[model samples]
Target: MRLTTIGFDADDTLWQNEQFFRVTEERFADLLTDYAESKHLKQRLLEAEMRNLKLYGFGIKGFTLSMIETALDVTAGKVPTSTIATIMEIGRELLQHPIEPLAHAAETLETLSGRYRLVLVTKGDLFDQERKLAQSGLGDFFDGVEIVSDKTVETYVRVFNRHGDGPDKSMMVGNSLKSDVIPAIRAGGWGVFVPHALTWAFEREEPPVNEPRFREVPDLGALATVLAEIEST
Candidate 1:
């Protein structure tokens, strides 16, 4: 319970991210409706995303590529030029979307800033993540930012060691169990799961059964209380 540094995952945890993706996905489906059913198009796009994760990593750019690839696949490489243009436009719009902080995001960060060293630990395109962080207006509340390629036990360990004393004195807070919670816990740190209403399917994972260091909160507003309880234990 002697947490000295706390890391936060950006995307859905602190800001409005997935909703934009969902919107763009819906648009993508609409653009391709003539060639494929909505359900089938969605399935193919998701498959493309999963397949391209290693090659493109994660970001709007990668997502754009996946969408285009899916379009080509579904249309048998005969997708109209206008459709491609629209998909690219969708990507540009997504990239330029405003960064909207979630409710209590700033307040929670402000509250925690005084008590613990706060760091932003997130994954995605470096430039895009940096841009969002800059736009968030929450940058000053963080002691450091780690825009990693992926979240893993080793990744958390390295980040904790570099930014704080060690994983034993660190905690990670975020919405994803796969990327944020389980990895942090496995790295010998406490993990606070703040569930988001719209999580990407790829980021979903079942919480560990009966783990004391793993906590689930309704939202970021509950984080301070959870931390206080952990501190008292």
Candidate 2:
């Protein structure tokens, strides 16, 4: 692989993200238990979130709205005003939560930054993503940052054109097979999947079964070793 640029997925790949969402979701379910069963509530919330994606894009604000909509739906428009207030509080707390980088995340980025053009490519609410990136302390290591609405093969091509030579010389490192890996490979780039234990269900997809440029490592700590091997051969 003759990789000259490396793109990174910000949320689960660089820091602890989905874990917070999972915690907040559990709290959301608990908050509405009196109105509906936990399993049913979860299913409803997921459905709402998926449905709202096109309308609200992606982020905490949209999630907050979805939670409110689900709460209303579950209770047939009778969910208490107090419960609505608490759900808003949940969204506020999540927005203010500290950004905790994964173990070895900074170290790995520092190691790779000097060797390649590092770009942070992630999709979400622009303001929230920008806030998290500022708080992460690893922002200085990246040559560019692309906060996109979605990750697709065309998106990868556009990002590479803006930051690097092209897709063939670029590599994407991320947690989601759907957003980060498959699309990058389809765009003619190398893709390194660093699986996170707690992935959101919507981001899950079957791995590329036999793609030569597709690679998977246990975590960010193993990335340098993988790159070194790739460079040696």
Evaluated at residue 161, the lDDT of candidate 1 is 96
Candidate 1, residue 34: Cα displacement in angstroms equals: 1.0
Write down the lDDT of every candidate, Cα atoms only: 0.94, 0.93
**lDDT agreement of model 1 with the native:** 0.94
Give one digit per residue, the lDDT tens place, for model 1 in 38-157: 999999999999999999998999999999999999999999999999999989999989999999999999998978989999999999999999999999999999999899999999
Once superposed on the true structure, which residue ranges of model 2 sit more than 4 Å away at CA? none
**Which tens-of-lDDT digit does each residue in 1-233 have in candidate 2?**
57789999999899889888889999999998888898999899999999999999888999999999999999999999999999999999888778999888999999988789999999988988999999999999999999998899999999998999999989999999999999999999999999999988899999997998889999999988878877887
Error of 1 at 183 (Å): 0.5
